[model samples]
Target: MKNVYITRVSKFLPNKPVANDTMEDRLGEINGKTSKGRRIVLRQNKIKTRYYAIDEEGNITHNNAQLTKEAVEGLCDESFSKHDIELLSCGTGSPDQILPSHAAMVHGFLQNGNVEINSPSGACCSGMNALKYAYMAVKSNQVNNAVCTGSERASSWMQSSIFEDEVQHLKTIEENPILAFNKDFLRWMLSDGAGAFLLENEPKGTTPLKIEWMEGYSYAHEIEACMYAGGDKLENGFLKPWSEYNSDQWSKQSLFAIKQDVKLLGKNILSKGVESLKNALEKHNLNAQDIDYYLPHISSYYFKENLYDEMKDNDIEIPWDNWFMNLSEVGNVGAGSIYLMLEELVNSGQLKKGDKILLSVPESARFSYAIALLTVH
Candidate 1:
């Protein structure tokens, strides 16, 4: 087996930044009742602003493919040819189209004739999985170089009118607004962005990040389907297919929606994640003292304290000062969050030769956890 390393990483964020104040006005009463404004949510979550691939009128300005193309293009060198990439590992929370796999679409955009492509779509964890897949390919000598990307166009799925319409329909039952859902919570939280990494079997120019080891775990049964698209959870605990609904019904219910119990997620995520993380570390013989930096893909500010507490309880003590996070700037970008954070840290030029970095990504859907160890030199 050969060693795999990340030669370069790049990111492409939407042009416009949507401030918390702006969304405070845009996201109206939650579930048709006076609710905490977006500012409160933003402040509580420690998020200042986020980028969206949409215009002022809530019209989508870019699709997934465009965002992905920009990210990948930025990572490529001027002399780099499309054929230089031997594998394309693409992942996303929501792709523009289901027919054409996101990886294949990106491959087409790159005009890279036929390289092995894999599209892993498991919400937030997909990005880490894609990178892991690329690492395995290069480590096994299946590919010389691979490009792994995580992209999302969340604005298109965030149709405020759909939630408003749902609120009106539920009014007949006189259901409590709080009991129904605010729907706009995630709409105001998630942002749009794409991040790409070029991985190679051998070192490239300058310092390359050697992939030490990677591990993943899932507690899907412990958590319900929290984040998803193209289907709705029915009262009978089954997913109601989007095809069953009429065109008008589909417009409101078919897109992304969060019906999970946040309290449950918050309660179990940290403990469950720490347990899994500890196992991975023990398996690889890694400990807090060995890590130089901790790059965590946390969803929101709410989880920060929980994560710290869990780590403390589990005897996994990594100082917060040694961690890097971009939640305040990028919001929770689902699968793209970790990649964007890595790009920002790399661009800061703080990491030097022989740095050991620990990367962890935790997904809401199914409570999936992905962790990796990297060595920079």
Candidate 2:
């Protein structure tokens, strides 16, 4: 098999960074009432700043397609252009439209040539899935080069206006006006951004990261959906998709609003990740000590310490010094997080040939994980 190397990495964070204290001011409050869980979630997330596609005046600045286009454009250089992109793979949890597909919209924005396109839709692991598609296409010699991205425009769905109908509907039914914690909790945590990587058969940069191996596992058979959107979770834990619900119920129930079963997430997330990580290492014949950098896409900093402790219990601890994270400064951009972290590290000029980087992405959407290994070349 041919080798695949990431030649360029780029990211686009829309508008300005919204501070912790001013998030509600940016996203707005539901029913003119501040969210009771806002402060608690912000404290646990430990995010100082995050980007949003909407302006302070709540104007549309960039949608998911535009954000992805901006990041993909960031890869253009004297050596490469959009015309040279043989394949495009894009992944996002929140797409601008459900009908035409996210990649089609991104390609329309690019207005590039007739390159083959793919869209892998999921939670955070969606980005890793996109990367795998590009990496495999290049490695298999099916394509000379590819551009892949993982991005999210969660602000669009999190805006208070999106939930206003549901709020009013609840009042009509004489139910609690306050949104459920499962619905409002993620509103405080997610951010808007896009990150792209250009993968090619040959390494281009002075320290291009070579794609080594990728592993993905889904525990959905063993567990129910822990995180979901565009659906409602039933008592039996089945996700009743938007298509099944009446069009009127869509707005009344806010079926499109992101929701999470926090109890299930907290109880099962870290342990599943740790075990999957251990298995991945064994499969690769690698040790934790071999990883020079450990980059993980953690939605909140609250899970960091707990995840580290769990890793230790599995006897697969990677030292804290080896860990690299940007969730604090950039917040959780969902799919784009790991790509952004990798971009920052690459731009940091801290790498040497042969340095190993382990990417740990856990998607609690259905208890799935994507673990990837890369080496500096």
Best-matching candidate per lDDT: 2
Q: Write the per-residue lDDT of candidate 2 for residues 1-377, one digit (tens) a residue.
A: 89999989999999888898889988899998999999999999899999999998889899999999999999998778888999999999999888698999999999988999999989899999999999999999999999999999999899999999989988987756899999999999999999999999988876799999999999999999999988999999888999998899999999898999999999999999998999999999999988999998898999999999999988899999999999988889888999999999999999999999999999989999999999999
Candidate 2 worst ten-residue window by lDDT:
169-178
Candidate lDDT scores, in order, read 0.79, 0.93
lDDT of 2: 0.93
Q: Which candidate number has the best TM-score?
A: 2
Off by over 4 Å in 2: 173-176
Any idea how many clashes model 1 has? 0
Task: Give the distance in Å from residue 82's predicted Cα in candidate 1 to where it truly belongs.
Answer: 3.0
The Cα error of candidate 1 at residue 373, in Å, is 0.3
